[model samples]
Target chain A: MSTKTDKIDRLAELTAQQESSSGASLWREALKRLRASKMALVGAWIIAVFLLLAIIGPWVAPYAPGQQWRGEVFVNRAEFVGARAENWFGLDHLGRDIFSRMLVGARQTLLLGVVSTLIGLSVGALIGSFSGACATLGGRVGQRIDSVVMRCIDIMLALPSLLLAVSVAAVLGQSMTTVMIAIGVVQIPVFARLLRGAMLVQGGSDYVLAAHSLGIRKRRIVLTQIMPNSLSPVIVQATLSLATAIIEAAALSFLGLGNPDSAKNPEWGVMLTQAQNYADSAPMMAVYPALAIIITALGFTLLGEAMREALDPKLRG
Target chain B: MSLLELDDVKVHFPVKKGLIFDRTVGHVYAVDGVSLSVEEGQTYGLVGESGCGKTTLGRSVLRLVDITDGSVNFDGTDLAKLPAEEMRTFRRRLQMVFQDPLGSLNPRQNIESILSEGMAAHGIGGTREERREKIRDILAKVGLPANALARYPHEFSGGQRQRIGIARALVLEPDVIICDEPVSALDVSIQAQVINLLEELQESLGLTYLVIAHDLAVVRHISDVIGVMYLGSLVEEAPSDALYAEPRHPYTKALMSAVPVPDPEVEDRRERILLTGDLPSPANPPAGCRFHTRCPWAQDTLCATERPALKDVGGGHKVACHFAAEIAAGTVERTAASVVPATREEMADRVVETPAE
Candidate 1:
């Protein structure tokens, strides 16, 4: 039998050796595997481009978005290149620059997507984690609360998300913050359910049990052990949820629920609304904003898929 | 005082109907009236077939599975009565190593993070360096290479992961560890490696263990005292040598006989005791003695009608049988022995009759 002193000394020596080695071992190998995923690299580039567009898009446009460029003839051709000077991508019924409007529209769409998702994730994560932690303490109370909350989520999920957002926007009045909150509210259920399910799975795992055995606090275990483990699935869900939020925001805005009376506002959905009347004369007006929405949504979806694959070992190659 | 004591602990879960409108009809009694104790620096082995509540008993001691009734006193504190905040403080002294090494450790965390997580949660160290130092020391003690700190769980072999799981438990300098079928999930050769590691760690650290497993060979190697569980109750318990040499409980005798001897020569000559049938469902266990349906020496009228208390026959050995002395004295041979084709067959019949009840 080895003495505790000897075990302690041996442990000290081993730890000292690990500290001296630096990042010369397995850290380098993990970096190599991350670099090898081609799709991830491509996804990274796409995200970078969208981020760049969102940052500098407004400054580079020739004309202010939503400002009418009078006397500019509308271009009718669907196959036009990036060569037009007056009303670039041709004139909408309002004679606004479609290219300029699309650029500014990118900023609003991206902001709405990111802000709403963050709000959803934070609110939903808190509710879900609290529900899980409460399940451990007030067993029956937690279950009843969980059922009520989940059923409410189920009701929201049953309705077409666009319809839910429109009604919420209609109730709260037409504004960007209202649209963001409406979209965020619609997304809460998805995050709440995802986090709750992940928590249930983590709550049963031995590591969590081990944490409990060590006399770790219920809050600490839920936050540190349960949250970290559950976050991966939540993250994956949040990524996909962002795309849906962006779509919902656009739908609400298109239905005239956006910032009304801001004639200078070039929100993507508002831009689509203005362009719909002149679809034949300037098809690019609708096409450019529609394409922007699809591509940005696509970016989040791909990133979400990659993250889900990376985090889930069962799904990993 | 005993370091840990459980008096008639039970863990039951309501079996909800799968259908939307199905009512909660009954409870799955995962553990029923299990009572046992472990002294400081001693290894107590809990042996039983799967679903016999061996794992459930271990989990309840940790309060991982909530106790439906009774009390668990750890170092003189009633664990079930402790507040949530106080319970967290109590958890650092007791740890658990699970059955599946892969399933137990978080897949997202690397070795260092996983090892250091317990220390961080319990606030064991004052600074980051102190925690890092503690993790480093534990990795080596478990025979893991120090450089393995940066690697994820997937990068390691099954044996290495089990070692990591052990390191996570030991890093906290815990007083008691409940190993729930720790080695049963590993390969045969790897099981020896893990068993040796656990024994070596125990000797060095004076760690007390509540080792739950079905593998008797592994149990015999590290256990000072062994408790045999059937359904959800401890049917027999005694020191390792005493229990193996002259098992008083018929269930234990059948279990000991079932352990395959390595040598073919001895294997051919030695008499084996086989039990019949699978474990009964814990949701609706049989009336009277839980093991009555499968007890080889079961007196149908007496065994089926009376639930025997765990009585001390002598020498700190306890057996819960109406006829324990008769069985222990060799006055009663298992009736199944004559009817069964082979000793192994009789042992199989005995184990199956209880069916996890």
Candidate 2:
């Protein structure tokens, strides 16, 4: 066997290397792939535009979104001041500016999607972390705890989402909190299961075995080593959950359970609810909110899917 | 007494079936009744093929995998019966260097965290600064730059990562380090560098090692005592020079013949003992001698019915075979045959009895 020490000297020769981002190789490589993907860029663009509109929409609107001015000399009952330069997207049957209402509605929609997703992600991720740790290194009692926790989650998953919302609403009176928490019911199980599964996989990985061999305590191992590695898939799920929340918003709007302040707050879902009443003559009104929700959902979905691909070890070089 | 003595070690993993109410249908005899010892300041190499119990045997020493039935006596203490909390404390004195360099180090943790976390857990140093100082010293010993502490595992080459893996083991200052296939995953030239590094560290640190590997050349190069394993048990054990000069077990003889000789003439003329059929699965191992299922010199009557216990031949050399003396003395004539023997059908019938896992 050759005993040349210079070979190892050359191996560690890159000690003068430039410092990169703090994220691990997995995240850095995934971020690089995301930056290169056309789909991610397009999705990011759509999301950015929606965010910008949500932020500056009220300032740019020509009229107050909730107010209806009857003296603005409207046209026929069916077609009220159709697409004029003065009122823009024209006056609605209630004499309010539809375009301004849509603009201000962007913030409400974004908030609805974001708040619900955040609630689900935080709660589900906590449950997932606990259950995953219990199952992986907890031995007999830990497995039992994981089994009970997962069974509860499974039962929650099996229940109809509407009933989950209604039950939640019953406990905490029906308001903005109820709507957001209820809408987020769809994501709890998905996040918990995803994080738990990720942790289970990393638990079996050689690194975790190495950690175990190091004599590090089991609790510390779970928190520091296992938890960090198990977050990629959960982050991707969080993004996808935003898209799900948007779809849930549509369904809630159809059921007239959307935005309790349908008149004052004027969310996209609220606008859609009002549009259905005038659907026979004003199809474009219904089309606007539907298209808005679809495009937003598509943006989040595209980004989430691309992220899933980027994080997949099988796809990496 | 030897620094590490394992007597009748067994690790049987239960094969469970059915969801919900999981039922243990059977057991996989991973490391069945393995007994060996490693003295302080000496390297004991355990060599075996893919499915052999070398890795499992190494793991059970540190209680990474629980020992089913045995006593692992280490420096006067019985490690096998140590409580989990006590095992954690015991690990400070007994560390392990893993196989995969990249897979062993946490991808998310930097070199500093990776090295220091163990020291912190074991309470090696008094303070954070003391720990960092100790970690730097270890990094230097393992041939890594002081600056490497800031980098992640993926930043370094395979050989460098191995150095860090060794450093992680060294930082613990364990009396005995179990290196499980340490240099097998590295490049050939790099393997030599890593091996040299390990040797240098062992010399300087006065550390004992139970090095497990499949590469015969690598094992022979560094080991003081070498054990050849088959299925889930060791078939032969001898000093490095004695085992290489003359391998008594039929399976070891086959392995020695497979090693390519440097001399061109000898390489061309040397008779190769090419055994037929796949290695029998450990889940359902052969009835008698584990290697008898594929042994060329296997006697039909004794090899298939009675298990062979490892017995001392002479001068510390041990062979677990029914006809070890006869095989070594050449009294039993070689059966007339090609690589595939004439009694293939008989062997096949015997092999068919134990269904592979």
For residues B103-165, could you state the per-residue lDDT of candidate 2 as single tens digits?
999888899999998988988899889999999899888888787887788888999999999
B-chain TM-score of model 1: 0.91
The worst-scoring run of ten residues by lDDT in candidate 2 chain A lies at A14-23
Q: Which pairs clash in the backbone of model 2?
A: none
Best by lDDT: 2
lDDT at A65 for candidate 2?
A: 80
Number of the top DockQ candidate: 2
Interface RMSD of each: 4.2, 2.7
10 residues in a row with least lDDT, candidate 1 chain A: A22-31
Docking quality level of the chain pair in candidate 1: acceptable
lDDT of 2 by residue, A1-317 (tens): 24467766655655434333232556778899999988899899999999999999999988898788776523345664456787777766687888898899899889999999998999999999999999999997998899999999999889887677666656666466667888777678878988999999999988888889899999999988999999999999889889888777766666656667766677877677777887777777777778888899999999998998888766976
Counting only residues 3 or more apart in sequence or on different chains, how many pairs clash (N, Cα, C under 3 Å) in candidate 1? 29
